[model samples]
Every structure is written in structure tokens, then in C-alpha cells.
Target: MHHTASSHSGPDHGTPRTVAAHRQAFHDLLAAFARPENTEQLPLLAALGRGLAMDILAPLDLPPFANSQMDGYAVRSADIPDAGAELRITDPIPAGAAPAALETGLAAPIMTGAMIPPGADAVVPIELAEPDVFPVPGKAATVRLPPVLAGTFVRDAGSDVRAGELALAAGTCLGPGQLGLLAALGITVVTVYRKARVLLVTTGDEVVEPGSPLAAGKIYDANGTLLEAAMRQAGLDVLRTGISTDSPDELLLLLRRHSPAVDLIVTTGGVSKGAYEVVRQATAAQEVEFLHVAMQPGGPQGLGRFDGTPFIGFPGNPVSCLISFEMFLRPVLGTLLGSPAPRPAVKARLASPLTSPEGKHQVRRGTLLPDGTVRLEGGAGSHLIHALANSNALVHVPVGTSALVAGEEVEVWTL
Candidate 1:
């Protein structure tokens, strides 16, 4: 059925279809058109949020030796009988000092990070020891330690990490913890996958840039800015963001001009069958297929190729545009571009009865319940950006589920 472009409204505007069908449609589109190719070198400090292309291996064992985990005495388990065995403190070892072999009937004073001498078994913190000052070896120095402590203060070699171990798997996004681990291993350089370059465009005469006077009914260009920011946050590198009037020639000109330089070209608005829909008319000749996807809020989707570049056209409504990105582009491209997969929805019970068309994927904005339940934030409307803003998850109510009564279990995706 052919539907003309209309004003964005609640989730009930389009013909209904299944969630699986919509997801498959997106996957097929990506298979046919998404071909990201770009690479760059970044310092380890700047590598956070970047994707790693190669696996990271530890060249040396973590800790590298058996060392004291605490400040206390290092003693051989054999020499120290049950409780109340006192051995003279023979040597005081501070942190980072090399290990010294233990002689029978002798104890070593070890600090945190110091290697345990040979023949030591465990670590006892200073607080657990009998309180007394110990004489320094070969010098007039003394250190205080609580006496009556048991166990040797030693950390086994390779206890934390073994040498030549795969520390980080390939394709892992280098987050702070991963970066810190690499830094601790003394790695200065790392190979990482490339980032996707996207071309973004905002269309419509009713849209104005920020700081511009708004004629009545005209609004600031929220979709463009919103899409760009969302893409960046997803670890995508936007190549160009252009604003096109409701003219087919201008839109095609801009797309064709920038197609060669970007991995994907994304446009917001004007893909619908509306009189002012320039993107639809222009891209139809470029082998782009327009589909009324089986989903709410973002039903009118256009996917095709311009020359050899992939282009995706989203609905103009602010919320609709963002939803399209999250539901469709962000998931697939994020993975292929080496970004982390979008977190799977947390389990949530339905807080209220939610109705849906017999055959459409309903992405609902809702509050997450403390006990893992989801309450609809407002009416399931695409223009309800306020509700979307407050929501941390999009409850995916599958197609054919005409209605879900309150307290029903549902899968939700964290926003």
C-alpha cells in the first residue's frame, strides 16, 4: 500500500508489520550498501572509545615475581612452627627491592610490592604482627612492626598475569580500563580498526539553524544536530552535514558531490511520498528502495546506493529520526565499524497495558522499574521527545502482540 508523507504523530500512523521483518530489512540494506573504509593512528591516551584491530598480549607476567602483598614479615612455612614462633628479622625489604634467598631460621621484613624472598609461603600484614622495632642490617637503622603475625608476605610470580597471554581480544573497544591495562604493560602503540565516515544531511524549509530568528511554525534544525551528536557518541566519524532545501536537484547534487568521500550518506526528512519530498524523487533514480518498514515512528525508510555509496533517509520528525538511528543504523554499523554492540535490553515487567498494531515493532519510551519493570513514560508517540528524553530504555514490544496487560514481561534496550 502506498501512503503519502504526513505530519509525524503518535506511534499509530503507519501500516503495521513485524519486528523481525523490519530488522531483516535493515540487515539486508546494510549488506547491500554499507562499506566503511577509513583508518588512522591515535595515541594510547586518545585511544579510548576507539576499536582495537589486533589482540593485546602480555609480554611479562603481572607482578613478575612473588612479592609481598602487605607490609610485614616473610618467613618459611617450615621454620615457623604453629603459633608463637619468633625468628629474628634478618633483613628489611622495602617495595620494589629484588628478592633475596631465605636462609633457614631467618625472617625478612617486606613492604608492599616487594618480592618475597625464596622459601617464603604467605603474607601477613604489619597490623597482624607483634608490635616492636627491628634492628637494621649492616647499618644503625630500625623499623617497627607488629609482632606475632603469621604467614609469609609474598606474592607468587605470574599471580596476576602470565607472560605471553592474550590480555585483550581483537575487536575490543579500548575503554579506560583496557587502556590502563595496556599502559601498565608498558605498551606505547596499538593497532586499532578504522572508524566509519558518515555524510549527514538535514532537509526541510521549515528548519532553521540555531541562533536564527524563527518565523512562526519554523523550528531549529534539531534532526541534523541530534543525528550528528548521536552518531559521534556511537563512535562514528561524520564526514559532512549539509542542509538541503525541499528541492530534488539540490539534494541530489549534494549527495552525489559528497558520496565519494564518505562511507555512508544519511539524510533526515523528505523520504516520504510527499509533494515536497525531494530526497525520495531524487534518490529513486539512484537505485534506492523505499520501504514502509514494519515499525512504528520510523516506518518510512529509504535505503539505496548513490553511484556506489550507501545512503539512508530517515523521517523528518526529531524523535523519529533519532529512533531510526538507534533501531537501525547504530546497531549494524556500530559492529561493522568495530564499536561495541548496543546493550541488550534489560528485562522489565510491563507497568501498564500497552496496545500495538497487529504487525509492527513498537519501540516505546518508558521508565525502568526498580524491580525490572517498564512503565510507559507517555503515549507511544514519536513526537513525544520529552518522554523519550526521560527514558533510559526502549521497550521492544514485538509485532502481532496486539496488547500487553500490565505486569507482563518484556525485553528492553537501554538507550
Candidate 2:
């Protein structure tokens, strides 16, 4: 139970907690305040874009042998039969060297990843032979290939992945084609999954920090540069601190000085119910809770823990702290960072009419339309940060419906 909220007796909160039960109580308070993240290893050029904490296998055979995907001659396809048949070149492999065996009516000039020489089987393209280049080595050449077929350009040996297979599976994400297939399988390092540091904060005494100066009723701190650019675009690491004011002992001494380095505290404008909330009076005595989830711009929120880390909070509107980090911490940090691409939700249509409130869950912002139609861009108002900077899609609506009408469809999400 570590604090739960959303009960407001029987009227306001009793029936408001729905946005899918407060996003499944922030996925069971981040699976009981998460804490597994430690993997590392890295190196494949510092594991570009991270995430894969295991399963990579294939440490060899990804084209680890039968090479030469063309640079001319290799032969043995019944020693070039039809068209012109000249075959006699010999010695010229040049790609990492190691070719010697093609004697029977020789033709080996290779080059283009080289290696396939022991009595070759097929390559033919140095622009289809007939003296198309590489032939000098100690003179006496003869190239004229035309009958190509036995594995035509050749590149086999586990043609991409098979030194025991499963080249990349443990939550893969690396990217540039999985780090160019782990650098063509030589692999150099790679374990990954650590990232999520996150401290962020951002409370408010009327905010104001963006280039300072403002005073009458403050307001500039767009939720600390909008939740530190949405927690560094969801890859986490953040830290921030910045605004904090409505003091609850300076927000519990800034959450006990960044709760020993951070693994998720988030906060953003004291958890609502106004009158200088200060993260609901600095974790009112630890466990947290706050609530009000029916969702709209972002319905108040606030999860648990703080000294034990894992907090959450989020509400002083910058589009309700980026629609509550796109409805509860971007799908639980894309499933605790195993994120191999998650986004999803699409559907479109609604170009105009909207409303929403009978039970909660509204979202809004929109824009999608390139014929797909979504529209909205600012009105349900949660201090409209320029309508979430001219929208890019969120829409949703759900909970016992209240209005919708302009052509209808809906769903959206995609920001």
C-alpha cells in the first residue's frame, strides 16, 4: 500500500480514477519502484542507441567464409561453358588474401570481399569478364567468363548469421541495422540496458527560469524545459532540479539531495489541489499518492516513494507536464527500456468537434491530418503550451464518452 489516493470520499475522486486505473497505478508503481537496470559491457562503438542486454550469439559465420560477391572471375561453374569461355587467369584474390586452390582451367581473379577460392563455384562479374580488369600478376592471363550459375556471385557460409545463430534478440534496439549486424558479426563488446537515471523535479513558486527576469505572477519554467525535454526523449539520464520553490523544507531538501543519484523521481509542479502544493507538501511524510487521474490535459497524478527513489508527480501544466509524460511515463519507459520500438496507437479521422469529461480520459492536442485527419491543437486547456507546441498527435478521449462528432474515428497517441 505505500500510499494510494484517488478516493476523495465519494464524489470527486470516488469515480474519477480511471484512465485505465491510473495507468494501472503507474504499472503497479513502476513494478514496486523498479530497480534492476545494471547491464553495461558496451563498446560496439559504445553500443549506439543502447538497450539489448543479452542474446546476441552468432559470433562468427555471418559471411565468415565463402565470400566474393563479385569483382570478376572465380570460375568452376563447369569452367565457363557457353558464350565465350576463356578461363585461365590465376592468382589475384586481393581482399584480405587467402586464395590458392582453383587450378582446373584456372580463373580466380576474385576481389569484392575475396575469399572463395578452393576450386571456386561461381562469381563472373568484374563486369562479366572479357578482360574487364585485374589480370597482370606475372602475366599470362585469359578471362572470358559467360556461363554463370552455381551459386552465382557467391556469399554463403552462414549467409548472414549462423555461428550458432540468434544474432540479436534480447530486447534488441542498437539500430543502424543493429550496429551493422554487430559489426558484421565480429561483435566487439555489447551488453547494454542501463540508462534510466532521471531526477528532474521542477516544482514552482510561480516557476520562472527560462532566461530569468520575469516576476509578476512568474511563469516561464515550462515544467523545467518541459520535463527536461521529456526525460531526454525517454532514454532517461536527466538529473535537472532547477525550479523547486513552494518549499516544504525546500522540497525535502530537494528530495534528500537527489535521493542518492536518482533512478527515477520526476516531479513537476507540486501535485495540485493548489495553495502552494510543493510536491504535495514534500511527500507529506514519505509514501506519496496525490491522485486525480481521469485524464484530460493530464489530471494531477503523483506516484509513490522518494527517499527510496521512484517518485513521479507531474502536473503544473506545460500541457499537463507533457500529457503526464504521454500518459504515465512513456509506457513505463517503453517497458523498462527493453524498447525495441514501441509507439503504436494510430486510427485518426476527427477533424473538429470534441468535448469530453463525463468520467475523464480526454488527452487532445492532435494534428495528424494529411488526409488522415485529427485536428484539435489546443482548447481543453491545461495552460496550453502553445497547444503542445502545435501538436503532433495525442487525441485519445475514451472513458464513458462525452462528445466527439466531427467525422469521428479517434485513438491517435504518436507524439
The per-model lDDT (C-alpha) reads 0.73, 0.77
Residue-level error in angstroms, candidate 2, position 201:
10
Q: Evaluate model 1: give its lDDT.
A: 0.73
Clash pairs (backbone) in predicted model 2? 72-125, 72-126, 294-361
**What C-alpha lDDT, on a 0 to 100 scale, does residue 378 get in candidate 2?**
67
Q: What is the TM-score of each candidate against the true structure?
A: 0.85, 0.37
Q: Write the per-residue lDDT of candidate 2 for residues 80-186, one digit (tens) a residue.
A: 66765877787788898887788788887778887898878888888766767786788987877778788888998888777987988876667788888888877
Off by over 4 Å in 2: 1-99, 104-115, 118-153, 156-180, 183-185, 190-194, 199-254, 257-260, 268-270, 276-295, 299-313, 316-323, 327-415
- Candidate whose TM-score is highest: 1
Candidate 2: lDDT over CA atoms?
A: 0.77
Model 1's C-alpha root-mean-square deviation from the true structure amounts to 5.1
